[model samples]
Target: MKKLAVIAVLILLAMPSNGLFNFHRKAIHFNVSHEKYVPPFLFWRWNERNVVIEYFDIVRNNDSIAANITAYLAIPPSLPNQEIMDIEFEPEPDKILEDEYGQKVACYKLKLAPNESLEIGWRIQAKIYNIRYILLPFLVGDYIPPDIKEKYTRDGEMYKIHDPYIQQIVRSIAANETNLLIKAIKLHDYVIRHLSYALDNKWDDAPTVLKRGNGSCSEYCFAYIALCRAAGIPAKYKGGTYLAELPPYNDSIFHRMVLIYLPNYGWIPVDMTFDEWIFHHYAFGFHSNRFFALMTGGGASQYLNWTYNSHYESVAKLDIDSTARWLEWK
Candidate 1:
């Protein structure tokens, strides 16, 4: 983590290409300095709730030969806005490992004979809070640390930040905006205005989604993230389950949201899909207290990578029965 030394100012400079004789002027220039005016408050009063995430997973072998199975499950992580109260696992996993993206995953190993099954269940108690930041346009950090910029701004398979189409869109939408916060807001709103919620079997990247003009929730996030990155803003995805009902709920649907790195504010949550359901409002710096985050800082594959494999020539199947409910609320 990079630390500031006594209110230091960082400037972003674009270097020239090869050839010493031909010097090029910097195309991108920005400065990070102290805010001119201080607001009464920077963050709004947060609303909180307590909930429990419970799930059961079953892996079965249908072959005539014995086989070994390995599985990975995401552990509910603690964030600045969300806390993990407690966790209970039935037949505990073998080990817990952190993935490259910083998501905690519980690894389970099982050996089953022919026509046998293994069951893994767990319950996680968490306290989640709604995040609402009163962001000032100038106060939003224009300078992203080199490490974060490198990690988050890179174009991915589904995050086509470098695509000409995406770059063109971002330049048109936010090219003239000097304020990082406003630029990010413009990109976020553009995604919402252009893309309508629609179910699609194929997962499309930013350019594809933008061209279609409509996509699923994850597509909305992909498009927004790509635009933000192209505009020199650091952004990533976070996946989790949305706690929307009382206990005894059973549904396989999962939700994903974008996390944009704001200089002084840190990573802020943005959920356009959830916001659209609520009368098409802007959810740039606000998140409902109903999320059970599983992974952060990666594309959709980070969460969907869970699998069951076997060495023998045997067929295996996975089934999950999951439910989340309010444990305590105020």
Candidate 2:
């Protein structure tokens, strides 16, 4: 058990994301260009070292009859620069699921005797870094294939795609521009300039965020997503653990970014809140791989989709301790 704030409420909200990028590539379709990724000149710089994560949930049953509990948590997959190692869990999850978005999940179906307190934890080591993307501008088009766009672009209860305000904003951002990448960069810049960072007043949605002009990472990311979808770009949210909260974000680890599909690129990462860092050459891809991506989608988490039952109390949390990075979190 770490501190009170760091490792509690692991169960998280999901979100949506992107389109037009900020690059100067001419307008083009998905099939118009080949893969344009080139290794960055600086092969490697910072290694955030290894982050030990312990995800645990405490479930207390106060009822007389046996209490049934269903719990699920998101586990990140190991990617090229990002590696996952030494995974462990107690009372092993009843089952593991590979969600539609390809997230690896651990699930537990349990029966808690009356007055029993059940705790389950999953621990792992994450080798993290700043994931870099090719800096050269790539072609981003105005249209995305219907089959592809609908999956990420749909207006959900949180996205508020039907909002007239959001619709107008997206249109103004596009302004007859067909380059999806440029549009994305414009949206990124819009959020950076418009919204001042602050704790959310309520469940932050795009319209709400736009109206306030200040929000958490989720709010900024959601506002960006809403604008992208409205502009016909397929986008979705990326939820993760920021290795260490810096400057505007504070000590909170729960963080959010966006992933917009570019014409040639499969799905590139973007972080409106950290756009300045990218713009100033702080890191490539906006996401400094500094954060560990655990879940995606809207606030309705897919990680918890398998969890639901009668009266009970539950929360998800992670403990991240690191050195050299000067990071301390629970």
Candidate 3:
């Protein structure tokens, strides 16, 4: 396996090639499992029951298969009598599977939410054999952070003695002399070196992870997003499952990673979970279509663009049916 530092150097060296920036199509198949509950047509309850709803699954055949899948369990407030109870989205799963030669092919299942506390079960499957090639350009974009962003930025300054590691990662990318791939590798290496995988620690913002240097998939993602943005590179936080031989709950199991858009190569997946896995493929040598892409972008508050939530019990809840209302409202 290539060291994270080595990969960063190579990525830096490979920049400035117009031919390198192009999208390759892929074929994909995915299955999501979660629990969902619909209030009995006429039941009037004071609190909302937890329900897990699945979203985003569409498969189109071309040069490669591409699909984005996500699910949320939330409470909905309806009428004068409905109240939401404790709602939680736990054990979220993310994965992607590709054919041996990078051809789109696969059979896989990813757990989007835990079954133990879910009221509804959800799944999405897609297969695409033909895909087209396209170029991904570097476009400057702005992301309006949710309420959480302000909190984390403040916490980062007040709680930590100036994160030297964060500064290092930002400097590497901002130098801008290196290629996009190199910038990405440096950012990925930084996270793998500084952050420890802690699936149990639920992180709602970036500062919490920066302060602890330990967190679940969300924390890792937040760090990556923060670093990339600091470098003036446009990056997005992606969540989904990876199809591997390991069990889903194993500390060794890999969940989600950040995918950055390369000027030429559209969206490329990066797995800080196993920096070695990325290095093995991007550097050392190991290739397999065992991963899949799910949801992309950060602070899932944007999901509210399509989803709505009401307090069911003192916990977070979502009412997917209101998605129509969002569209109509827009």
Q: By lDDT, who's the top model here? A: 1
lDDT score, candidate 1: 0.66
Question: Which regions of candidate 3 are displaced past 4 Å?
Answer: 1-118, 128-169, 172-178, 244-254, 276-288, 304-330
lDDT per prediction?
A: 0.66, 0.57, 0.37
Winner by TM-score between candidate 3 and candidate 1: 1
| Residue 121, candidate 1: C-alpha displacement in angstroms | 3.5
Candidate 1's C-alpha runs over 4 A off are: 1-41, 62-67, 112-115, 279-281, 300-330
> Poorest 10 consecutive residues of model 2 by lDDT?
10-19
Which ten residues in a row are the worst by lDDT in model 3?
Answer: 321-330
TM-score of each: 0.78, 0.70, 0.43
Q: Which regions in candidate 2 have their CA more than 4 angstroms from the true location? A: 1-48, 61-66, 113-116, 138-147, 200-202, 245-253, 276-284, 298-330
TM-score of structure candidate 1: 0.78
Candidate 2: deviation at residue 266, Å? 2.5
Two-way lDDT contest, 1 vs 3, winner: 1
Per-residue CA lDDT of model 3 for 41-61, tens digit only, reads 111111112222222222221
